[model samples]
Target: MIVETDGYIDLIQYLTENLPVLSEQQGSKAGTSSYTLRECFEEQLSVQIMSVCQQNDLDQTMRIDIVREADAILYDFEEVLASVLDNHPTLEQEEFVTEFIGLIKNLFDARVKA
Candidate 1:
């Protein structure tokens, strides 16, 4: 469930689309509201990660576990996405969507099964 990019927009969308139930369970509306989740994940995760990236001025480099909580969040989303995709085979996979879809598939294949 590594968020393979800079700004984390894709990662935020992935989380919101997948883990709506997390908000109910958490009872903080953290994961339910896409806007709130984006603000939080960005303020909490993206900001720190971007700071490092900006300081280094690196176009792209591997960032592992920038936010300790992200691992759990990603796992939750991966589960949700995998279940949805598994149930909905008619879902289209296109270039614009494949970045997130492919990552979710990889997450399911690698992390969920393992």
Candidate 2:
């Protein structure tokens, strides 16, 4: 049910822009103790993707693939994405949370099925 449609484009841009800040807000406990999978995903996938977004080398598709791969490895990836989207106070689309989760699941399935 997913394709490279307008929703996909919006989801990707939103993720590319906001996920980094969300991760920062989530804030990894630096020198405290052990880390949760969410923490790892935030640091590895979210933060790293922000850096990748800053660089001019990778295309949007490449960025998407990176997110998909990261999702494949992280448990509850959909929840993570939803939380990121849900927590945004300035988010324009108020009702896009569930649909965005589906879009992300599509990408996640693509990576996993491959």
Candidate 3:
């Protein structure tokens, strides 16, 4: 199932709007345990993606298709990061990419579970 461009746009918007909350959650969860930037980013991303999937009532298959479609449009990870940052300057690039990776992974995981 090919996901529409509009769908990807909506997903991006959802992610952007929720970033601050996600980042705060990550910080709170870590407590005094220090994590590398990568680790922190990944955890936050995963949580946010899962939340979005649940909220949207997106089944495993639909989540997978959406990730695949978004990936196809961006071509590669670097490009995906660049595209997201370019579109959302207010967001820290590293954080945005980390969440993007989490979104992609969770979407694929949904497919695997199905």
Candidate 4:
């Protein structure tokens, strides 16, 4: 919900800094993000969001709360999310997106229950 409200970039930036250190290897880290690494998700989401806005005739730039706009365009996500992942051809991207969605959903679910 916050992602929808604030847009995903802030969360992505926070996660880039806070994403768990799952494992480390030989001066390389896996499953974490560098600030620039965040650009990939930001760019892809922006592109997909723009496409959704265009198709729905809703200007995303006019959105005061991105998640709210996205909340209204829920069906579009199921379609766009796949494309976003498709645009990125790396296991890390897939894993990051999937896991991030899971975490966000779980968080939202918990909030609703409360």
Candidate 1 ranges beyond 4 A from true positions: 1-21, 25-35, 54-114
Worst 10 residues of 2 by lDDT: 86-95
Query: Which 10 consecutive positions of candidate 1 have the poorest summed lDDT?
Result: 87-96
Model 4 TM-score is 0.33
TM-scores of all models? 0.24, 0.30, 0.33, 0.33
Candidate 3 per-residue lDDT over residues 1-114, each given as its tens digit: 323445445655665575453444233233343544344444555565565566676768877765555446444323333423223222343445565656555554554355
Each model's number of backbone clashes? 0, 0, 0, 1
- Using alpha carbons, what is the TM-score of model 2? 0.30
Query: What's the lDDT for residue 77 in model 1?
Result: 46
The superposed Cα distance between candidate 4 and the true structure at residue 67, in angstroms, equals 7.2
Error of 2 at 48 (Å): 1.0
**Model 3 residue 107 lDDT?**
53
**Any residue pairs clashing in model 4, and if so which?**
4-67
- Selected candidate, larger TM-score, 1 vs 4: 4
Ranked by lDDT from best down, the candidates are: 3, 2, 4, 1
| Candidate 4 wrongly placed segments (more than 4 Å) | 1-10, 16-87
lDDT against the true structure, each candidate: 0.39, 0.46, 0.48, 0.43
Quote model 3's TM-score: 0.33
